[model samples]
Target chain A: MVIAAIAIARIHDLFAVVMLTGIFSLLGAAAYVVMDAVDVAFTEAAVGAGASTVLMLGTLALTTSKERPAPAKNVISALIVVVFTGVVLIYGTLDMPIYGDPMAPIHHHVADHYLGKSSAEVGLPNVVTSVLASYRSYDTLGETFVIFTAAAGVLAILGQSRLPRRHHDQEDSEKGMVSSPEKSKGAST
Target chain B: MEQFPGLIPYWVIMVLMMMGLYIVIAHGNLIKKIVGLNVFQVSVFLLYITMAKVEGGTAPILAEGIKLYSNPLPHVLILTAIVVGVATTALGLALVVRIHNAYGTIEDEEIDKLEDQT
Candidate 1:
């Protein structure tokens, strides 16, 4: 997974990068399966690896798939920032519970009830389903709303008419849409 | 090694997260940035699932005579997040297409230069 992410960062071809991300997500899902998170693994594989890749490819169809090399100056600054943040996060992880420690605090919370009493309260074999559909069903409802908003946002943004038929459709309109007042100052004025 | 048992997952996750961060920060392409965002989000989802693991646990689905199941809460949360993640990704790509339409270029430098002129 880490290797795929590194490849993604280093590769300049957007198409290849998108494919690697799908592979990386698949690797992540495999890891989840190993960790006993079958439900999450299923969802990650289906959505992260499957749907998102298709969406990215569709975007690539509309846009350039080759990344222009960045100017060389900001490289060092970005590396420095990333390294510093990573160090702080690793330090934070030092005190975390050992991996897969059954006695970890995370297991003792409402997770305990959803596991222990869920059979009686919700009467389902799958605690994840019961919790998702019943216990924290409102959160799921909110998530559905969020998805609805996203779909609406996509339609609102892309569905409008008078789409850019050509570069110079409306000279005044183009000038009006100019966001920067610096370079195009003479033209817009 | 004795002091830290199973801390390896964090190391892997952190490395992946940093790579994602670097891609988003260092690269200027909008589609590439979206891909970077997905990588970062996946690393986080991995973190949650890793935490949900038990020393010797099975999936959260109850089975006959099975007393050990990994925590189900993270699974439920991540299930919602994955779907939402895809929805928002599609929305983001739609926005990118719009940006491409408006500017005829998706590179930030070009977009900025175009914006600066007008």
Candidate 2:
């Protein structure tokens, strides 16, 4: 996963970067499985590896596949800031309870309630489902509403059912294949 | 053994998060920034799951004779978050496509230059 991320940073080809992002997502999903979160692993694999890659590929078809070389100055400064923040965050994690310690506070209150009472209360084999569908059903409803709003927002933004207009015609054509207005207009007409 | 409880996972996650931050800050490309944002998000999700872990625990499913289970709350929450993240990513990509349509360029510096000339 780390290797994929590093490669993504080094590679300027947008297509390869998108593929690497999928790889990264897949690796994260695998890591979730190792950590015993099957549900998250499944969702991450489906959404992260599947849906996101396709959407990004569609976006890549519209946009330039080759990223312009970044100017040199900002990168160094950004690296310094990022390194500093990274150190601080690592230090902060020192205080967190060790991994998988059942005695840790996170396992006590709310999680305790869900895991202990979920089966009896919700009568479900999957405690995660019970919590999501029964115990915290209202939150799930609100999240469903949030997804609806996001869909609405995406439609509002891209609802015209049109491919992106080639705005850079006067400058340079990155893809060369996606010609000017006439070709993009083909879909709508 | 001792290392699992040590800083290894946190270190890795932190480094990943910082890399995401660096990409967002240093790269001028809008799409790459969004990708970086996902890297950052996944790392944070991993952090939550890490905290939610219980030694010798199985996935958060009920089964006969299975006494220990990893915390379900974070998994449930992250499930929702992943869905929401997908929505937001779609929205963001949609907006990015629009920005490309409007500005003719997705590079931050070029867009700035164009705006300045106008």
Candidate 3:
């Protein structure tokens, strides 16, 4: 994953970068699987690697592929900010519980109750699903609405009439609505 | 040295997080920034999943004989976050397409220059 991330940072071609990001997400999903989070791995693979790559490629088709080199001054400032943030995060980690420690506060607080009671209460095999869809269904509902709002926002911005016809062609292709077969035949003939 | 083994994963996550932050801060391309943001979000997902892991536990699916299971709370929360993250990515990309259509360039510096001129 680290190697993929380094490649993504160094590579300038947007297509290559997009492909690398997909690989990176897949690697993360694999890591999740190793950590016993199969559900997370599934969602990560489907959303992070699948949908995100397609969306980014569509954006790339509508825009340029090469990134303009950032100004030298900006690079230095960015490096400084990143270093500071990293230091703070590392400091924060010093007090965190070790990996897979069963006695960790997070595991004891609410997770234990869910793990104990969810199968009986929710009558589901998958505890994660039970918690998400039944125990905390309100949060899930809000998240669904959030996704709805985001889709609405995208339509508002890039709807057919909002974009010019040339770019609208790209959007149409995105929706799998290409020119009719007769139009294609006429153009070819 | 005693604490080193347990803390190693956190250090790696920190490095990955910083790399994403650098890309977002240093890169000028709008799409690249979005990619960086996704990378950053993935690291956070890893962080949460890592915490939820039990040394020898299986997944949270109930079974007849299985006694140990990884924490389900983080998995549930991250599942919602993953969906939201993708939605945000889609919206951001849509906005990027509009920016390109309006400005003819998605590079940050060029957009600034165009805005200054206008």
Per-prediction TM-score, chain A only?
A: 0.85, 0.83, 0.85
lDDT, candidate 2, B1-118, per-residue tens: 4545555787888889988898888899999988999888888888887877899999988888999999999998998888777767777776776677668778999989988987
Task: Tell me the lDDT of model 1 at A11.
Answer: 89
* Cα DockQ of the candidate 2 complex: 0.54
> Which portions of model 1 show Cα errors greater than 4 Å?
A161-189
State each model's CA lDDT, in order: 0.81, 0.79, 0.84
Give the 10-residue window scoring lowest on summed lDDT in candidate 1 chain A. A180-189
Model 1 agreement with the true structure over A125-160: per-residue lDDT tens digits: 999999999999999999988877777676666664
For every model in order, what is the iRMS?
7.5, 4.9, 6.3
- iRMS of candidate 1, one decimal? 7.5
lDDT score at residue A36, model 1, on the 0-100 scale: 91
Model 1, residue A23: C-alpha shift (Å): 0.7
lDDT of 3 by residue, B1-118 (tens): 4566888899899999999999999999999999999999999999999999988899999999999999999999999999889888887887787777667778898888888986
The DockQ-based CAPRI class assigned to model 3 is medium
Interface DockQ of candidate 1: 0.55
Report, for all candidates in order, the number of backbone clashes: 5, 0, 0
State the DockQ, from 0 to 1, for candidate 3: 0.59
Model 3 misplaced regions, further than 4 Å = A160-189
TM-score: the better of candidates 1 and 2 = 1
